[model samples]
Target: MKRNPMDFMPAYFTVAFVWFTTHFGGGFASGRQLVEFFVQYGWYALFTPVIAIAINALVFYYAWDFSVAHQKFQYRSWTDAFYKPYERVFSNLYDVVFNLVLVVATAVAFATGGATLADVLGTPYLLNTLVIAIIMFILTIYGANIVRAAASWIAVIVITGLLFIYGSNLVVTLPNLMTVLNEAPAPRGFWYALWQSIKYAGLQAALLGGYVAVTDVLKNKQDVKRAAICGFILNAGIMVLASAVVLSYYPTIISEAVPVVFIIRNGFGGVALELLVSLLIFLGVISTGVNLIYGGSKRIVSVWAKPEEGEKSIKNKRIIASGIYVFITWSIALMGLIPLVAIGYSYVAYLALPIVVIPVLYKGITKRGGEKGKSNELDAMTAADGPKA
Candidate 1:
């Protein structure tokens, strides 16, 4: 099963795009999260992405290495790898809380997509919601390969669109950028702001398991290494650019519901702005929703399937699970976007602090007591068997 890293080039790109799209959707693209988590910190906010990149990189690297070593592609196995005596407790907690967050977050994405399409096409919200739900459900049933491919390429298009929007806005704002930076206030100190930034990144806990679970596709440490680097750059690069644009218009657009849309309308205006903004929101919502559903189903099906189950049987279970998952998410999507994102996202960020950040980072850094040997065993297995786990 192990092959040349060159042979897995597509997987590398798929993982990178999946990681980017997973975090880059809904709250993130809406510029709502950017305003609250990044721009609100004033001049120090510039450093927020730096801290986030570091934390994301550290956590991602550990997850990738650990997953590959143990041949653990599911979230439960991942928890078992590190939690051990407390694996049952932590795994159960993570499975419940992480899925809850993902379902709500995916619903937020679905709701946003529906609203954006309805706004653009003058269609009814219900019709838009039904269509979006159907499309997402179809994508989920196709499972990981199709989802990853769609998300990866769609992410490229979205990011390119973002660069156009943010890049143009930044060019215009650069004239007044110095004044904005000087006048921006730090409501909290730099250290506190930095802590908030790290917490914001940790809110991504729901996506972490799936992100690392892609190790099932990878063939070598070099592939995982390159994938991590590419993923971090794609994600961090966008965050920095988007944060700077938000900061450029800080204080003024801070209170807007979707600050980035406001900036785009002001700069681009008319049909062009509408097309761009609609595309951004619609694509962002679908990409995140698909990744979340795909990820959760992967983990859930892994939990349900017997160890000796054949690939076809496991896939059949995924189809059933994905259908049920999509229905629940669609129901939640009816709650709408603003309330789901504004209220729900921040609390999840705080919860992730202890549940995901501390335990994973501690184990990854310390390598723990017996984990080194476990890692070696994994390396030996990989060496002998050629990455079939």
Candidate 2:
């Protein structure tokens, strides 16, 4: 009755897809984040995705290695590793910053969903936000199990739909693409663009660390490395493709509330296809919101409850925490999507660089190039039931 090891392949891809979706979310899906961070840079944007991919790979590997080495799977453990005697102080700071950013990110997702609903179905913005928030709560109330069940499949479908939609846009724009490329403006310039890309990657790096912590139970270095590689390739490939599509229609679509949706609605030129793509993106936003709230609430529970705590008690704590997060995010979502992505995410990106990304890079650079005691420790931890709380 033992599960086949080969079965882990699908699970591994599922985790990979979840990792991709966690970062993609509403902002990326709508083309707002890409326009701000990448498309605005003109031809220089091409280089940014490569850099983001490298940083993503390093951050992911660091997260996985840290998780397996200490048998701890949350941000608190990273604090312990990096801050030493001041673990509590640093960890609490990380916890606060992370949760605050997560709240804002969830709100951004809600806002994106609301915008999509309004554009596609003419729904009121407030009503759309409320409906999305309620649905997110329903999914998150069940914790990571529900998120895990929904996220990967949602990611696959949405990403595939995006490819088709964006690819079609690219084809339509191909004849004028050269003219468009020549006229593109680099308002931020190359150096600023490079820095923005790095900062943006750092923002996602912090979340990726915590996500890898909560969702993946790392069995070995190979598992960690495999997931890291898969995550990086998927993240980079999708972002690059999405950015290319945005670049093809830049400046014109930049001011729109939901750029990608707008591009699809107008450019794709079919009512049914446009609606299907819009619905898929709206679902993607919801899925990302669910994953964010679930991950953040689970981390809060892990920090508050001891690893020895009973499952029922832990589950109750997660539901309560997720409920509070959902309420706050729903309120903040009314502030709108542009401000959320423009101001909130940009600030968090800078904060995350030094705190989360650098520490991970430092660890990777300094750790002895050998597994040594890592395997034995992981074995012992798994024997002890594996990071319970």
Candidate 3:
């Protein structure tokens, strides 16, 4: 099939954006994650949105650029593209950690989603896992395009509703907003706030990198770059708005598992609020599930596809691999390991920082030495590794 370059960028960007937003799952939707990381810091949470946006932007920018560059050279995956440039003991360590992290993340998603579904619907968690696992398997077996189409429209609706709810509260509660802010407890020190911001940003960036991997399908570098920029802006704006809404209802939000729902119920009341919250949470869970299945399945399949070696007939292999992955994920979920894994993986994500930072750092150092550095170092590395496929 002849590829259409024009559709590539938008499609890729859309997929990437869906992946990014959905990465944090129920955490992002409920604001509990933010509360855990930022709100506890009180007024220090104000700087979090800014630091997170900047870090995410930088991470996405580098990942997107590297993906496009390496894809043009026929690289099949980020690991294929980056592993060589960063070849070392630590690079191998990163590969092991990265792959393990991906597996653990998908497992956690399945577990948590199952738990949430069971809790909300009053079904057994195992039943929920069975159902979600089947659905995820079907969606992932098809590929990224199907995943993108299924999620894109639903994501738009959820994001729009969230924005409306948050925006309305910002306006209606504006008169008392300052009072709420003043009453909020402050952080212990500037250093604490700084560390909190870095932690939040680093965690978010690691999650965002998985999203950027899907951008390899994008034909237009400009579209990928533009989409990332716009996506970061949208994310930052929403985070800020959410933080404000959260702080407005501060101290009270401390006890809420789902703070966004709390804000909606308190701000709007009645059927409108209920319906919006329901839709928001549903879409949030569904989009996130789809992305996890897609990314996890793709990674599993790619390991065996061996594009460089001209392997074929891997479709059956991919399906089987994906099924096993879903099975393991569902099993762990049924065992109620999701929350523990999610919390553990948050730190494991820090393990990815060195992997991501090294390439960008190398790029910077090479840039300083002009063409000589590139010719001696990067080109040599590329020549030694050869083209990916």
Candidate 4:
């Protein structure tokens, strides 16, 4: 039976949800990054979500268009599309920056996962990091299909569990919600607040490009758009819910590095809550790790492995590349190099800002204009694919 593209649209939504949730892991969920950008500014911190959503919408819009036009469903990383236009200076810059960032991000995730495991299960951080890396490596080596299956199941459980936890906190802290909002100090000024919001949102969207690459495989532009919008809504809702949960215990959250864990401990003291939170955290890290490894491996394999030419098998090459990455990331993490790597990669992302912003603008405007005005190559490709020219 031939599968209709429309039938896969719902899958895109799931893909988007998993993508956003995974990207939102390290800093956004921790509240550390949010605090650095918004909370310090006070009441104005509320605007951060708005800014983040707008940027996310724009990025996803282009990502969907690029995927549909190309008709190539295996774009496991945005750099593939990004390299299409600015192949000379910008593409090279993007490639370098993305790999560098992935290395650091993977390391950070490993470290964080270890720390979370230690906190929740009394396991050593070093051992936990190795365990996660090994599991993630094996999963990536198998391929995206396997990763997607795991992510789909885990996302359902994590989202449902988080909703329950946040909902309970909201009800219990109803009175304090408004007080926290009103009494919080306003940012130093409107401009400072706005810039902080922009930077925070921009960085997140930029990094999320790697995750959005998977959507390229979806055959329908409409599906891509719908999925992106749905994903954006879900992400915003979760962020708001998370913020509310943390704010309920503002004092405790303000000092704690892992606010989500703290919220669980304070709001639900039983072993059940601890176990649930631990599982959610573990799944969150695993989903993100798998996505990162898959993205990195795909990029390397596509460039170096010439399976069509019979030089190497793409699948086997991908497995080898993924293993190498996992080993390197784990080794760096074991050496306690996560912090320095994270900071360096952040700087590299700043450098790659131009590469991301330009193509995103081009894709959005051209795609929004309709197929007639699209580039000649894209129009011909779409026509060949029978998308109604």
Model 2 bad stretches (over 4 Å): 1-9, 306-309, 368-389
Residue by residue across 1-389, what tens digits does model 4's lDDT show?
Answer: 11223344355765676566566554554455455556656656555666766676777677566656654333333344445544566556666666776776677667667776788889998899888888888877665446556666776787798788777777877677688776675547777777666665555555543564355445577777777787777777776676665665655466565666776676654577766766776677677777777777776766675535442366677778888988887776654433433364457446545656556766677654233223222212211111221
lDDT of 2: 0.71
Q: Which pairs of residues have clashing backbones in candidate 1? A: none
Candidates 3 and 4 compared by TM-score, better number = 4
lDDT of 2 by residue, 170-192 (tens): 78766555666677678878888
Residue 264 lDDT (model 4): 68
RMSD of each: 4.1, 3.9, 5.9, 5.1
Q: Please give, for residues 1-389, the per-residue lDDT of candidate 3 as tens digits.
A: 11222243355446445654565465666676667666766776766777866676766666666655554211224544455544465445655554555555555556555555554556777776677678777866665455566566765676687788888888866655678677767656667766666666655554543464355445555766776677777677778787877877767787775676677667755557655665565556556666655555555555555444322344465577768877776665544442534375567557655655445445534542122112122212211111221
* Residue range 234-267, candidate 1, lDDT tens digits: 8888888888877877688877767776777666
- TM-scores of the candidates are 0.88, 0.88, 0.79, 0.83
User: Model 3, which residues run further than 4 Å from truth?
Assistant: 1-9, 12-16, 72-77, 83-85, 88-91, 100-108, 111-126, 172-176, 306-312, 334-342, 358-389
Q: After superposition, how far is residue 149 of candidate 1 from its true place, in Å?
A: 1.1
Model 3: which residue pairs collide? Answer: none
